[model samples]
Target: MSHSRRSILGAALGLPAAVAVGTVATATPAAAAAVDATAWTNLELETGITPQPGATPQVRTVTILGTTFLQARGAITCNLAADTKIGTLPAAMTPPTWYVRATSPRNNSQGINACRFEVNTAGSVTIYGATSGNPITWVQFDSVQTIWR
Candidate 1:
């Protein structure tokens, strides 16, 4: 005799959906072994900051997943005006790996737009300018994807 899937399963297991979904935990040992070898410890932006600070700060935030994916972007301003105040990462990143960089200068100031930044494991980030470097104003942005298990 022929039987529908639901009829065969529901009659035999008393629940077609449960049986179809393999809800029978005792049916296999693999079901119980579905635990993650590397549990998802945490998740966050690579740069941490979505935007820096200034009259026209341009910044972006990125969310890094696992150990194989990243996305970063931002929008900033540059005009060789006052030291440009881009955005900053939040205080929640990897660590001991802090470094800063300067976007392309808007005008020709002989490296007047140089900058420095820091990133602690705990996610604390800070950005500073060189003694000779100042900010600008146009529209420049950056992103850094930092992730950890």
Candidate 2:
């Protein structure tokens, strides 16, 4: 006997009737395993900020798919004339977790700027000056837990 397309698909899937069930199958251990957030608890930036004339900010690696998350704070630039702002990190950054920022110096005086970072995986990140206008100072403060999933 020959099976129709419906029968073939059903047989292949090992399901009952053609009536589609709204419920989806749960992911197996191999398919979806829980990520450990604690592994990235102590992740930190390896490099410091390097000021330049028009250099772009850097994105350091952090973590992903974990239960715990990390929050980091640091300083970027010391250019008093221009206003410095931190930029968002890359999407799905794994190994080299990092972030970037831009500096706008209003004057020549030195200015101290600060920033914070949060990671959801066990990873490391770095923050560096993006612009070449003036070399910005960097200072990492601390990493704290924000949420656990």
Estimate, for each residue in 88-128, the C-alpha lDDT of model 1 and write its tens digit: 34324233333333333232346554333333344443344
Off by over 4 Å in 1: 1-71, 77-108, 112-114, 136-139, 143-149
lDDT of 2 by residue, 32-127 (tens): 444433221222223433333333333332334432233333334333222333333344544323322222222231353433333323432333
TM-score of each: 0.29, 0.25
Best by TM-score: 1
Global fold similarity of model 1 (TM-score):
0.29
Candidate 1 positional error at 39, Å: 19
For candidate 1, the clash count comes to 31
Candidate 1 lDDT score at position 83: 35
